[model samples]
Target: MIELNVAIKDKYYENSETAVLSQLDFKVNSGEFLAIIGPSGCGKTTLLNMISGLESCVGQHISYSSNSSGNRFKKNDLASDCSKSEYLENEQANRIGYIFQQPRLMPWLTVRENIELVLDPTQFNKIEGLLAEVGLAQKGDYFPSQLSGGMQRRVSIARAFAINPQLLLLDEPFNSLDAPTAGRLRKLLLDLCREKKTTVVFVTHDLQEAIYLADRIIFLSDSPCTIIHESIINFPKPRTESGIAELEFQAKLTRQFPLLLAGKID
Candidate 1:
């Protein structure tokens, strides 16, 4: 299992003294998709940055712990007591993948080259397999500018999985795609994660997306953000649009979500 323990903490913007994420406590379990949603300007992005250890933080600590699922591991556990920058540098050694809001691939590189960029030179052979897995095998020669937004995102997702990270962090990764395409990609991504048993922590503002993808939904309040609600989605598996049609579940979740966002939950 991959676990996240975030204690009550505070963080501020550089130079100025203003807390962005304050007094937060949250946890995510393995094989789980925990989606976070909140009001505008609620510091959701800042909270994600802290979890990925991309930014410096104070007053609280976020820790990551992982256990095996009987698969091949390339190296020792990447979890460590290191600074954010230092941890980012060890990407090659870690199994934590990230899909940013933007498909931040290099324009100069072809799709294949972009995916291969994250792998060590010795792992070049792994590139083709990852591309095929993401359904981008035929577009290997195309550049980012030549592909549709969905295709570009696929390449990004492929690159993130090339290293087989234990954690996958997504920041509204499907924001640019059409509904059907996004739904397809979501299924593919979920399948891939099931194959690797990767734990995911995703951030999004869409309530439907949250309902469709998350095993648990984490709700954050406005600025000086803190988790106000953590609701488990107990619908039966292989979840689909049809499953969410349960009037009881729909009414219950829909009715409570507003209260959660409003910080009115106990």
Candidate 2:
């Protein structure tokens, strides 16, 4: 089943003559991990902002649907200005989870409190399990400042999954960390997604990261971004970050579009 269908005819910055994204379209399947990778300013973030309703798709040729069963972001509903906090409410039971570039945890709150903040009262009970799942069970009482960057990121992952969201959006959530830390977190994310049966739409500029994580990847062009390349990772699950198969696949991609993987648009 298709979990998300996004077709944004075009997006532009106010007072700008050039379009940031044009004729962009993509769909994510239920329980599948989809990654979008492109150069630095290819409207990757803007595309996510539109999907999460942080950016208005008003007066544009954008059509987004969360799944017919949930009917989220219906074509006519594109005008709605829904903020991230506004989505934490149980009222929007569609449960589309999102992990921003930063951990975005409140400093004053403890790790547990940070997770509890986004969850409904009924889900507060999941905090302990989630904390353990993210390897932060003992640090639940620790503040965000007390935790390492990777641990803090784990909290963000836990918070998003706490909602048991059917669709999760991540915007370069691991780009800043060291290789080992990011690798561990990536493995954690993979485990959680599988256990929870979550469908993910991950955005990144890292070619290997996308290759290591996604079932399929969509590469975008530069400004006026649109799909430039599509590749499906056929290696079975239980794959390593730089496994032989992954490296081989990555090599093939690099050979085919050397410029594209280097964040130079094809």
Candidate 3:
């Protein structure tokens, strides 16, 4: 399980500070797929960064708990940690895998090489299998430049799963794809998540995407983002658009989207 109570601030002007997110508290149960949706610039990416240890927040209190052990850390713990290796080791950070908005692949490396770079040497033998899992078995030797945008994103997904992370953090990774492409990728993601039993925190602006993928949906307010509304998605797994389209609960949630954006909900 992951628990977070965090606040974030940024310098908007020379002497002024703006609250990007405030008092956002939520918990993601083990093996649950949680989706966060909010207006643009509402610190969605910032939240992911904090969780991934990529960025720090001013008033952060987060913890990670598993069957074996648990650790609690405050914002100060991150600042005082001197080495990346030490911090990762202490926080069990190696169990985290993040997919950013862009593919972020290296131009010089082939697809297989890029994925292999992050995998443990002991797991090198699984590289071929992982590539095939993402439908890139034939393209492993191809460089990023040779693939289409969607294919590159597939490579990114394969790279992330290569580590077999316990927790996956995705930051609008499909925002740029067309609707059909995005839908296909979402199914691919769902299949992998089910197979791995990994906990996921997916950030996206598309309500339909959230409805289709998440076990629960969290709606956030604008800047100084807070959870204004949340709903449990009871749809059965291996979901499809046609299957959910006829559900009244899905319709109710769809109607609530406007109110969520208007911050009219209590």
lDDT of 3 by residue, 106-172 (tens): 9899998999898778888998998888888899899999999899999999989998877899999
> What is the alpha-carbon lDDT for the whole of candidate 2?
0.82
Best by lDDT: 2
Please identify model 1 stretches exceeding 4 Å from their true place. 69-93, 242-248, 257-266
What are the clash counts of all predictions, listed in order?
A: 3, 0, 0
Worst 10 residues of 3 by lDDT: 5-14
Clashing pairs in 2: none
Off by over 4 Å in 2: 60-93, 262-266
lDDT of 2 by residue, 153-217 (tens): 99999999998887789999998999999999999999999898888999999888998899999
Q: In candidate 1, what are the lDDT values of residues 139-210, reduced to their tens digit?
A: 999989999899898899898888787788998899878998998888888888888878888888777777
Ranking by lDDT: 2, 3, 1
Best by TM-score: 2
Give the winner by lDDT: 1 or 3: 3
